[model samples]
Each structure stands twice: as C-alpha cells, then as structure tokens.
Target chain A: MISVLLIGKGNIATHLFEAFSNLKEIKVTQINSRELDNIPNADITIIAVSDDAIAEVSNKINNNFVVHTSGSFAMTHLKNKTRKGVFYMLQTFTKNKKVDFSKVPFCLEAEDKNDYQLLEKLAKLLSEHNYNIDSEQRKRLHVAAVFVNNFTNHMYKIGNDICKENNIPFKILGPLIDETASKIKTLSPEKAQTGPAIRNDEETIKNHLNLLSENNKEIYKLLTKSIQNGN
Target chain B: MISVLLIGKGNIATHLFEAFSNLKEIKVTQINSRELDNIPNADITIIAVSDDAIAEVSNKINNNFVVHTSGSFAMTHLKNKTRKGVFYMLQTFTKNKKVDFSKVPFCLEAEDKNDYQLLEKLAKLLSEHNYNIDSEQRKRLHVAAVFVNNFTNHMYKIGNDICKENNIPFKILGPLIDETASKIKTLSPEKAQTGPAIRNDEETIKNHLNLLSENNKEIYKLLTKSIQNGN
Candidate 1:
C-alpha cells in the first residue's frame, strides 16, 4: 500500500483527496496550508495548492518523493531536498461538482525512474488516462487548457449575456455548446468549424455584428478574421 | 401520418431527413435544392437549404404550409405564397456524423396559429427540447449561438494550434474542453469562469502571452482584457 500526503484545501486539493480516498490500495492524509508544521511522513507528498503557494508549501514538506498538482509549475519548483515530480491533472475542478478522475488526463513528471514509477502508479490509481509529460509539455498543456477551458467559458458568458439582454433563456444554447465540444473529439476544431466567418458570408457577418455590443463586436471581428485567415 | 417535403442536400437537411425518417408517424421526402422544379406536395414543406438559398427555394414550393430551417433568416424570408414559419435547430451539424435530434433545441416561429402548431408538432417529433421562439428571439438565439458554438470552437482551434506548436497532442485538452462546456449547463458561464485573467494574475497571464504567437497574443490580450473588465 502506498501512503500519500496532500497539501492545500482548494478545489484541486479537495477533489484529489476525494478521488484518492476512493482507492483501497492508497492511504492518504490531507492538510490545509496553515497546518504546515504537522506534515506527515508518507511515500509521496503532493502540494495541490495555488500556483503562488506551491513553492512555499513544498518547502515545508520533507518526503522521499514530492509532487505538485500544477500544470504550469515545473517539478523543480518543489525546493525540498528530495525526489520531485509533477502530478498535474489537466482539468478544471468545481467545489460542488464531483469529478470523475478516470476521464481526467493526468500529466506526470519525475526526474528519477523509481520516483516516476511511483508517481505513475499513484496516478493510475486515480485515472487510466495518465501520461508521462515533462515540465515543458505540461506548461504548454496548461496554456492550451486556458484557451479551451477559460476562453471557451468566456464565450459562453458572452452567449449568456446576449441571451439575457434579449430576454431569451440561456439554456437554449446548452445542447449547441455540448455539440461544439463533442465535435472536437472526433473532428479537428479546424474541420468542425462552421460559421459565417468560415463561409465568409459578409452579409450574415454584418448582421451579427450589428446585433453585438461594442466589446463583443471587437471579439466577433477579431475571431472572425482569425477564422477567415484559417488560424 | 404527416407528410413532409424537405428541400436541400446540406448538413442540416440531411440530418433532418434522417431524423424525421426514423419516426413511423412522419413520412419525409428529401429533395436536393437543384430539383426545385419537381417540388412535391406535402402537409408541410421545409426548405432546409443554405440561408442564401432559403428564399429562392421557398419560392418554388406551393405547399399550404412552408417553413425554412435557418437561425439567421426570419420567417418572412420564405417568399412562398403559402403560410410561412421558421424551424431552426440550434445545433451544429456535421456531414458524416449522426446527430440525435432528441437533444437538439428546435426554435419554432410562425405567423399563423395553425402554422405555428404544425411547425411545433414537427419540431416535437424531432426533439423534446423545442421552444416557441419568435423571429426576433430566434435571431438573438442565433447570434448567441455564434458566440457559444462558433467563437467557442475558435478558442478550441487556438488551443489546438498551441498544442501542435508545442508538439503536444491536442487531445490532451479534450477533457478540459468537455468539462468547461458541461459546467455551463448548471452554472451561468459568468459564475463558471476561471483563469489567470479572471483571477487577475498578471504574472501568469504575462507568461502565457509571451509563449503565444503575434496573432494569438492579440487574442489573449483582448480576451484577457475582456475578462478583467468583467465582461
């Protein structure tokens, strides 16, 4: 049985703790950042704190193998004098919603082979979709994630705003949003792309622009231009 | 049994034809737009052609009840001497993929009460998620869809581009994309928003912008600003 120590109490930390707790073979202990002095002795210590708090939290932990659950941070961010690795789950976590770790892509990184195996074993306990990704690749993945998750959510916000302004139910766009995301699984976003921008339907584009607010118009124009330029 | 004539060979028309054909109570006859001269008589004729072809195609059909399936076009765009209505399915249609119209949101509009009921009945046969949306409301829904579907897909395209440039598989971000779309179903997108921009983490935003290309940089900055401004 592998023993694990989880640091922080944020969304990622809470969800990771719940996911780890479900596995019979893994024994896990979770502590908030304030309880740094009581760091438990475990096979692996995971710092699942905020990006700004990762290094500071890692400094307090002294374990044989240390890992962080941050996509942007490098393994070396853990200044602890021990084996370091990253156990970044490429997903967004909400406090109330339960996450199925099995579908989540875990990007694991470690310098030592034994440490890598340990991390991979632990990751496999939580998800079947784990990968051995380096810091560089994980960093790129985080940026790509921001576009897919954060920016994409912003587009939904814009749609909701449009719906609210027109007194239409935002729920009307739910299935369309789901379909848009699902399409990318089978087709490349380039191939799945369909809009006035792709067709270069100037009249429809103009009509849409007329309906949008100034800021939305700017976004619509820029994205339309990007789509038209085949970006 | 209700007899329906579908005009168009495009993605929406084909999918509508397949969806309607599955129902034993509905008999659907699909014809390509090029065969407009041989328009068939039916209880209701639906012109599911391109937005540009909707008017011209509708002009050829002499059915008592005529409708065009377009989100952007108004019901009056159907220039047929017969009764007019709009049947807009608010989902992205791909040529090779089969769409489960049951989950698709159908926005129905008609001037006459009987025509409206006919269109609504047809929509209900395709989807349980039908709405009796007027032309104005449908127009807003269409614009909102552009943001939710088109703009959101562009964000995915950008993410794909970033992953390709970094030599990381774009599929790595699939779960994140799916989760982002799924979250909005329960939470408003504004409340669901998260990222460096939303958190106002200038440092991380700066790092991301530095890694992006010139065109991507512009989008990143614009979207970041939009997010920061609470739009």
Candidate 2:
C-alpha cells in the first residue's frame, strides 16, 4: 500500500488528490500549500503548487520521498535531505473537467532506484503511459505542450473570431478541428498538412488575406512563411 | 430517383460519389474531368474538379441544374446556362480516410428558391448538417478553415519537431492534443487559452524559447505576442 500526501489546493493538486484517493492500495491526504507546519507522514509527498511557491514549500517538507508536479522545475530543487523526485502529468488539469487518467502521460523521475520503482508502480496503477523522463526531457515536453495545446487553441480562437464577424456559427468547424487533432496519430503532422501554404496556391492565399482583419492578418502571414520555409 | 453526375475523380468527388451511390434514391455517375466530351445529363450535375477547372468544366455540363464543389469559388462562377449553384463541404477529405457525412457541414448556395430546395433536399438525403450559405459567408468560412485546420496542424508539427530533437516520443503529447481540441467545443477558445503566454509568465516563456530550434523560435515569439495582445 502507498500512503500519499499532496500539498496545494489548486487545480493540479485537487485532481491528483481525487485520483489517488480512488485507488484501493493508496491512502491519500491533502493540505493547502500554506499549512505545511504539521505536514503528515506518507510514503510519497507530492507538492503540486505553483512554480514560484515550489522552493519554499519543498524546503518545509521532511518526507522520505518529495516530488513536485511542476514541468519546468527540476526534481533536484526539492530541499528535503531524504530523497527527491518528480511526478509531472503531461496534461492540463481543469477544475471541473473529468480527466481520463488512463490516457494522461505520467513523466516520473527519482534520484535512487527504489524511489523510482515505487513511483513507477504507483504510476502504473493510474496509467499505462508512464515515461522515465529526466529534467532536460521534461523541459522539452513542457514547451512542446505550449505549442500543441495552448498555441493550437489560439488558432481556434482566431477561427472563432472570423466566424463571429461573418455571422457564421462556430460549431460548423467542430468536425474539422477533431480531425486535425486525430490525424497526427496516424500521419505525422508534417505529411498530414494541406492548405494554401503547403500547396503554394498564391491566388487563394491572396484572397484569404483580403478577408482577414489586421490582427489575424499578421499571424496568417507569419505562419504561412514559416510553414513554407520548414516544408 | 435523382440522376446525379459527378465530374473529376479527385478526393472530394470520389468521396461524394461513394456517399451518393450508397443511397437508393440517388443514381450517381462519376467521370474524370478529362473525359468531359461525353458529358452525361442528370437532374443535378456536380463538377467537383479543381478550383481552376471549375469554370471550364461547368461550362460544358448541359444538365438542368449544375453545382461546383469549390469553397473559395463563388456559385455565380459556374457557367452552366441552365442554373448555377454550389455544394461546398467544409471538411478536409483525404483520399483513403473515411469521412463522416453526418458531421460534414454542407454549405449550399443557389440562384433561386427552387434550386436551393433541391440542393437542400439532396444534402438532407446524405447528411443532417445543411446550411443555406451565401458566397460571402463561404469565403469567410474558407479563411477560417485555413486557421483552424491548416495553421493549427503546423503548430502540432513544430511540437513534433521538438519531441524528435529531445528523443521524446511524439505520441506522449497525443492526449494533450485531443484535450485541447475537444475543450474548445465546450469553452470558447478565448476562455480555453492557457500556458505561459496567456499568464504572461516571462520566465517560462524565455525557457521555452531557449528549447526551440531557430526556425520555431520566431514562431514562438510571434504567437506569444499575439496571444498576449489579443487576450
């Protein structure tokens, strides 16, 4: 059985607490990041707090195994004398959204063999997608997440803005959005791409540019140039 | 029975012909655009050739009602002497990938009410998603599609490139990609936006820029600035 103590009341921590509590072989305890004075003992102590608070919070925890959930922060940042680790889930955790934990990739790290195995065992219980990613690799994944998740959503926002201005319903693009996301699984994004940029359809490109407002026009031009250069 | 003639055996025409031929109410005939000399007559003639060939192909069809399946081309561009219309499907059609007709948004346009009804009836026979979209709105939709589908996939390509360089399996980011696409279906992309750029976390942004290649660095900065300015 694994006893886990999670610190932080934010979205990531709350989601972790709930997920851990559901497993029969796990005993989970949660506490706010501010209330670290009387921190409970556990086999695994996870600090799922903000990036800025990670140092201060880890400095106070005296658990046998200390891990932070920050993608950017390294496991060595943990000030505890016993051991250090990282249990970063490589997916965004929203407050009310139901996360399919089975699909969430758990990027686990530890200094010693025993602690690494323990974390791996716990991760295996939650998800099949477990990677022994070190700090350097985690840093790469973090930035990639920004492009595929956050920046990709921004593209959708611009599309929505265009639809709104033209009195077209935004949902008309739902199937295309889903297809774009799923296509990468089978075909690499580089090969799956299709549009004016890739085809060099200058006439269509000019026509599309005339339809866009000032803000997206700048974006439209830059991305087009980038795609052309890369491809 | 409705006699439907489809010109051009490209991706869109092939898919449409397959869909129409499956229905018992529709008698569909497909011929290559090059074989236009022996043009068949039908109640509805669909010239699904390339955008450049749309005018020449439609000019040859002597059917009662004629439609071209080009999103950027206006319905009035069809030189059919009898009647002109459009049957634009707002989803990307790959050669081998199966298309879900029910989810495809059929943007139909016609010169008169009777022609519009006939197209609507045909669209309803194949799929539930039918709209009386004009040339102007379709032009808006075409540009919006470029943003949502084409540009968005480019972001995924950049992310994949980062993963390849770091030896991180690109599939590790698959769930995150699916979630990002699905999240926008419920929340507006404006509200759905997250990550360092939206939060104005300069430290994380700087770190992310350091990880990207020289090609994606410019893209990262531009998208980051755009997200900040818009949000």
Q: Best candidate, DockQ-wise? A: 1
Please list all clashing residue pairs in model 2, or write none if there are none.
Answer: none
Tell me, by lDDT, which candidate is best: 2
Docking class of 1: high
User: Residues A1-231, candidate 1, lDDT per residue (tens digit)?
Assistant: 999998888998898888889889999999988888767889988888888888887787778888988878888768888889998888988878999888999888999999889988988887788788899878877888888899899999999998898888888889899999999888999999998999999999999889888999999999999999987
Candidate 2 chain A lDDT trough over 10 residues, lowest sum: A73-82
Give fnat, all candidates: 0.92, 0.86
Reference-based lDDT, each prediction: 0.87, 0.90
iRMSD, per candidate, in listed order: 0.9, 1.1
| Per-residue lDDT of candidate 2, residues A80-199 (tens digit) | 887999999999777799888999999999999999999999899899999999999999899999999988999999999988988999999998999999888899999999989999
DockQ of each: 0.87, 0.83
For candidate 2 chain B, the 10 contiguous residues with the lowest summed lDDT are B210-219
lDDT of 2 at B184: 83
- What are the runs in model 1 whose C-alpha is more than 4 Å off? none
| TM agreement with the true structure for every prediction | 0.96, 0.98
The TM-score measured for candidate 1 stands at 0.96
